[model samples]
Target: MFARRALRAAAPAFAAGAAACGATTAWLADEADAGMFVVRPGLSASEYKPLVVGGVRQHTDGTTRVRFVMEEPDLELGAVAAAHLMAKASIDGAEVAGRVAPVSPLTAKGYFELAAAAAGDSAMSKAISSLKTGDVVQFKGPVQGFQVGRNQFKSVGILARGDGIADALQVATKLLSDPRDDTEIRLVYSVRSADQIVLRNHIDALALLHPRFKALIVADEAAPQWTGPTGPLSKPLLASILPPPTEGDSTVILVAGDVDAASGKATKARAAGVLGAMQYSPAQVRSL
Candidate 1:
């Protein structure tokens, strides 16, 4: 005991050591990032972290969604508002970014997702081409720019299309599961064709889960099985559902979809007086 006390007394008092130890101790799951994640625990903007491909889902639209699980079970890919991740398969490889899925972590717990093109010369396309189950891919981020002041909004709207709707759906689901006081959610999903309608089961479950929240689906051609609204997802249609958003960022509208759909819908939504149409792809994270 005397020798141990003498050693402790002789130990150098490195100020940074305490700070470093505090940093290490605060490495808990970032679910407590208020409403947005700016500082990640296991992930860094400058450091590249290796994640293994756990699975892949091939969508009918020639797009593929890859799922990567963190090496540690307790590790998490943070979420909400613009918190996102970027990944590269090999050194000097292409880079792809995606908002870590909400409600359900991509495919499984501790897993994150990235979207890749079927065929293209694009940087993201090239970067993810080699991804397969069990393969290692380097990840960067949890990068964020926008922050969400939860109580500031009177309501929230999500305009999404294609497979990208999955993320939006998850958000809606989370909102329903964990209702925000005095705030409402409006979710709209559009597909070019009825056959392209994926995740219908989850969508239906969410609709049933919270009847108060608006869930609208638009298809180019209405199929008999689809009991929801039909025709193109036009601003006129949305205008009927949601009053033109008032000024101020409080009226949050999350816009998700590919170039052909979301781009014009967002413009038209704004033209219809809808404000704060945040992009799910190009703006926050690129999975297209």
Candidate 2:
């Protein structure tokens, strides 16, 4: 009986190993900080435009209350990439840092949650208290967004120190498989060869399980040896993932650097066809 039990336990491990062998090679780093690309210093912040928008009060838990609103009103909120910046602020010339949090039903339109470690020192806290309804404040960060899960939505908020690509892929895959229901997971990213392999493998894997797990890849141009759907990521694909166009349901993936100008845009377009959108920079991903 003891031998039998031992063998039974080993069976699952053996199966897992076999699955991994057949699975496309995935570059997984254990540091929980892998796949991060950092923004280079000396890049003029002027490239970014700060937007003044309304923020809504969502539910508060502990010291944090979730808020939801489009980071930029003129731009179709769909254009915003997941895990990208929202705003940058400085208090008393001290750089005040905050990441975009995920959106949800509790999150009201034109508002998002901002928290501070304590009370007085954080600019977000001060802004939340001082700013009233319909008051516009200068805010600039990445166009962060979320993914769809089985029954819940995933958060698109990426820290400059967290695992970006891996985390996003994991969330997208889990959202598709675990539920055994009909649902779509949208993702976006700036294209890279390394990530293409992962995206292709993910699509192949999902195709085996869910026929409804449709995908769209959008890119400025095609890459060498690339094998997936390709196009300039369109509004139709964006609509599929974020039906009804609420802040809580959309996610944007941002990629920074001249890479976006070159292979990055093409890669992101490809990734968006299969995933959602590729919009995160290396620095932002590293913070994930």
Candidate 3:
């Protein structure tokens, strides 16, 4: 996690990024102090910049939201959509790297989430996992995304495992404030057990307050009295919550967590006609 002063120093750089396009940024704040989740400008698509970890938020599943403060507070990140972020970290003596999506076309809540250990070995972000406060990470840019060409899908269906919720929770926060109440949003979240479910209050609030949002929470193994959707997290269960995407419906599926879990939803979505669904992995936070 980054220390607080980094945000104060980076604010000007963020302003410059927005200023380059004559666009004024709207910094949205809720649940935290003003400007805590500062939005920095997108970085140059060609180079890697070194940044220090200012702070970190740890989750029970071992995922983390890492906040980096620019070593050069005055440095400017070039532009948004002009480039996306690719992060690298030096863990032990080895180098690790991965692509990060454009969350808000800038920073994703001022910190990036690192996915936990995953199956198939992809999207694990080993370099990032070893980071602690004051650690340095390298960030480069100009990458691809999983969105539908800036068309914000009117409907969002989320399928995430416990390891992925750290970042998905942030996404859910934004959806709550969507101008379109008609935005159809749903979550199919699963964990190993009740103890594995973190941030229960916020999740409950999203379901209760959002007119069109619902959650089907399940546990793979639970006490006999536990009553919720049971999960191994499969395609059949997904079909039950979110129907196949129709030609005219503007829908996007969001997948996060381990590579296997995220891939399952992406694969299922593509097969169901949702060709270009928006995908998210903890390692690739601030994603499109």
Candidate 4:
């Protein structure tokens, strides 16, 4: 009887151990699935850095070819952003400008040849086509890196559409323009100019509904002849958009431009002043 009782006691213990193991296994499985997850937050303007890659040759057509090695083939944009943040705390302040080899499965020769064929006759397309073996070209922008997770890597590879300086600037601008204080806004801007126009129109419509926005400032270089706010965006014009700064609340500036905010003293200085006044970067501006 004593032996039977002991066995009965041990049976529950064994079952409990088994249950614990099963739970652990399930947890591990779930974690494994989550390993490769990546979240692509909107790009930022302050992150733009001018990339200069040597040994890169541009084709007559304007396509550019670059050769670089990437250690992680599965890396996604989110992973790259995470890595960038780790390297630099303020992603908006620093820029990563260089042409390095893609990690794997995407050889330089293969990538350029395919890119050239796809690009056809565009300036960037021609530049990509001219890339010969072992060529390198520079990519300029606020380098937005990615975050790598278990079983997955995020990478916004150089040359991928929608990952350019203009796009980054649009995202940054939107964040700064957000009316809500606590809400986080994430967005992606397109490299295509037409998309930017559409975004500008949308913003104008929103302004009609919301009184906070007094006017929209568009860069003169790409300004259309539309009736609404269209012309060279100037500091005075931008200042007019925000209500006078109050003691507790501050004003924000939204700038949109293809010009490099760094490099020359003029652009850099202007950007700094704007950033301080607006408490945001150009990336926040949306086309609409």
Best TM-score among the predictions, by candidate number: 1
Model 1 per-residue lDDT tens digits across residues 34-132: 232122245556778887888877765455667777665645554444345655555345345533322244223366666645343244443554467
Please identify model 4 stretches exceeding 4 Å from their true place: 1-75, 79-142, 145-165, 168-225, 243-288
lDDT of each: 0.51, 0.34, 0.51, 0.27
Model 1 alpha-carbon drift over 4 Å, by segment: 1-40, 55-67, 90-109, 113-132, 145-149, 163-167, 220-231, 243-250, 257-288
Q: How should the candidates be ordered by TM-score, best one leading? A: 1, 3, 4, 2
lDDT of 2 by residue, 35-98 (tens): 3211111111234444443454432321333233444322212111233344455445555444
Deviation from native of the Cα of residue 55 in model 1, angstroms: 4.2
lDDT of 3 by residue, 210-246 (tens): 7677778777776676787664666556666753456
State how far residue 91 of model 3 sits from its true place (Å). Answer: 1.1
Candidate 2: stretches off by over 4 Å: 1-150, 153-165, 179-182, 187-196, 227-288
Candidate 2 vs candidate 3: the TM-score winner is 3
